[model samples]
Target: MKKIIGVDLGGTTTKFAILNEAGEIEQKWSISTDIEREGINIVPNIIDSINQQLSQSGLSSTDVLGIGMGSPGSVDIDKGTVIGAYNLNWKTLQQVKEQIEAGTSIPFYIDNDANVAALGEQWKGAGEGNANVVFITLGTGVGGGVVAEGKLVHGAGTAGEIGHMNVDPNGYECTCGNVGCLETVASATGVVHLAQDYAEGYAGDSELKGLIDQKQEITAKIVFDQAKKRDPLAKKVVDKFSFYLGLACGNIANILSPNAIVIGGGVSAAGDVLVDGVREYFEKYAFPPVKTSTEIKLAQLGNDAGVIGAGSLVKMSR
Candidate 1:
């Protein structure tokens, strides 16, 4: 039976999975990313882990179709190079393909982490059977990917950067050195920021206010939990977060008009609360045609989206 390896490379850990052509995970595991030497050992470490897994499974090189990987930072897919993955201390373009191929002697395909996640969702998760879709991940920072006309759109190798979409020119500054990017208002950090800002002037009684009084750090989960309980301040924070997220989605709808907008990541764990709230605003801000055409939903793949999407990359290339 032919199998493929799916790799989700993150700043701290790298997840690996073996999948058959049917997209079922036969086995999966992970290893801590070795970034001690400017990430020089990252690729080598990945190769070693792969070899170990293959040996343990009694699988040979010929039985494997290829390897697919999802990595952070800008990627030159054609060259299999990472332009810059700052979190991994990769400041220069690294020859990810050549290095990994040299080690494993298998063809490798790579893409931006967000893009692969979107691909994964489209293949077997929330966007399954849909050719046109957009995936937004609201984690520590926002990330986005777009699949248009049954293909991943990578115009100039920088397509689907939904998080950087300018939402508020005068709003909070984003880590991307921009003011009020969608990430600043719709991500996990953004939610907490909104909660803190709302608490400053809120005189009403709320659990968030008590946390503030106690100098306890507030999180997006806390805000969502409080809002579900009808805490006024937390509700306000959620309302603001949803508004910006919806506005961004509306803009995307106007531009791409995909079949569905799939939401994922840590913040999305809030489930219906987050999806329903964003849909409300998306409908309000989007054009009528776009509003009715696009469906908003949560991603079903969870952490597996990355690995499955990576595996899909190999299948797509074949």
Candidate 2:
């Protein structure tokens, strides 16, 4: 009957789940993330929802052991402080955690969202049973998490940032104020950018061209579908993007030497087309022993990884 609360805070939504000590979800809910307000303001909404759910279940806040939150910023884990969350406009992690704790007496634990997702995957998803693993999330923006030596590598809260690594130094500008970051070429948005660049000079007839009108709604999904149908231009775009992604994975492997690389996010739905291309390219780009040693697999946790990982914070902290 023991329970814990897991909070996954994102730019659009804040997902919460009540999990038993044995890892079963008792209830789940969500609220708008309120990007316009300061990060601290969202805390009361979260607490209120948790309390409502607990009351509906004939329980109380005291029945829960603690709360864990996955945030989108650098965190000082030891201090329970958020060092910087420019996107959330939060000045510190400690302030956000304290605000949430102030709403209740339970202990709170927080970490970067991607890192937490990695832990979630390791605990119950694709990375299960693997002590060393790399998790890459390919969404509007790319994010990553690393597990090494049976532990999540924090490296002072800045560790698993494969997205910001320089992949194409002269290619595109990223929101992180970097030029040619891996995220610029390997994320869902990155794929769209590559598709647009390819569509401009594409002469071959294809269904993709007809799908989007004058506005160039070129999305990653369409490009993936076209690639699935063997469209040459779409295939080229995917390959180009995949090559950079493979190279980035290889680099991460070389440094971390993880047992597996788990890729998540919407774009991963492309399945084998994405996996094979990344693996093939990794063989060509990766360092000697690194390429041969690591196992590359798609993440299995999907949307639940964030909250699931949040739920397992107690394990990660130890």
Quantify all predictions' global Cα lDDT against the true fold: 0.92, 0.82
Candidate 2 is scored at a TM of: 0.89
Tell me how candidate 1 scores on lDDT. Answer: 0.92
Error of 1 at 165 (Å): 1.2
Q: Which stretches of candidate 1 lie over 4 Å from their true place?
A: none
Count of steric clashes across candidates, in order: 0, 4
Q: After superposing candidate 2 on the true structure, give the runs of residues whose Cα lies further than 4 Å from its correct spot.
A: 34-40, 83-94, 209-214, 287-289
Candidate 1 per-residue lDDT over residues 131-215, each given as its tens digit: 9999999999899899999999898768888889998889998888889899987888889888888999999889889997789
Could you estimate the TM-score for every candidate?
Answer: 0.96, 0.89
